[model samples]
Target: MLAFDISGSMLKIANDFLSTKASCNILLYQGDCTQLFPLRSNSLEGILSISVIQWLSEDSQIESFFKECYRCLQMNSTAVFQFYPNSPEHADQFVTVANTTGFHSYLIMDMPHKTPQ
Candidate 1:
């Protein structure tokens, strides 16, 4: 099963991804991902998010989002989130927010990619 949030061009990108993958249940959220309510608590094993959370600019919203994420995950579950930081400071802020919400801080990998045009 997969949970995805999409709007605009991302919806199309996600559609393209789904077209090539093995069949699995997919839930697409069209609005703000911060409003999502995860169903079947502790049921999801691997959660992946990419280049999304960077859009949130306010501390309160980030706090709420992290709280929700923590609530939605089961013990020992892993979430891999990749986001583009506005700057070094922004990256630090992201870490502070994630750790405050109870994630064990780990910088898994950092790679370079040209920003999409």
Candidate 2:
């Protein structure tokens, strides 16, 4: 699982995921998640980033990160991602980046409040 932002709730989710599932491997990193991806591995089956996309501060970087996410994933792979669509405009941009990334994705709602900057 590729958890972006590393926030408190996200950290709790990560901890739970780790404790409950011992069959998979997990790695942790600090900082922007978009730059943290594009991992080289044919073994990677999928990725996850919950309530993290909205924290993206730069539009260009988010787009680049989407590209990286596409590259890191293998064929038939998936990324269960989510984020708060604070405004219609912000939502549009996020959707645009994900759509243009050349990866199969879906818009998941029920996102929490925005992270404090």
Candidate 3:
């Protein structure tokens, strides 16, 4: 598993937790997520990113991140990211990036309401 984070402290915590709790191996990379990863092409089976991609400050970076993810994932693989976009445009940007990078992207929305009889 590859866990990418920008904060060194968070990475340390993740490494510590994985060392003690996880049976499988995990590689931790602390830096900009858009940069080229030190991994081979089509090397990863899946990616799990939580509340990270929204921090990307530019479209180029977002595009680069998606491209890198695409390059690293095997065919028919998946990537799960939890991002809270500031607006519809932000969400659309993510989808555009993913689609341009060859990922079939979909958004799942949760709506909760009390129904009146």
Misplaced by over 4 Å in model 3 are: 22-24, 111-117
Better of 1 and 3 by TM-score: 3
What lDDT score is found at residue 104 in candidate 3?
A: 94
RMSD of 3: 3.5
State in Å the error of residue 96, model 2: 0.9
Q: Model 3, range 6-111, lDDT digits (tens) per residue? A: 8999989888788787476777888878899888999999988889888997989998999999999999998997888888788888988889889999987444
Candidate 2 residues lying further than 4 Å off, grouped into runs, are 1-25, 36-38, 41-43, 111-117
Report the error of model 3 at residue 117, Å: 24
Please list the C-alpha lDDT of all candidates, in the order they appear. Answer: 0.74, 0.70, 0.86
**Position 20, candidate 2: lDDT:** 89
How many times do residue backbones clash in model 1?
A: 0
lDDT of 1 by residue, 1-117 (tens): 654564757767877888788975676556566765555656667668788779889988777777677777899988877888877778788789989998875655476446778
TM-score of 1: 0.76
lDDT at 75, model 3: 93
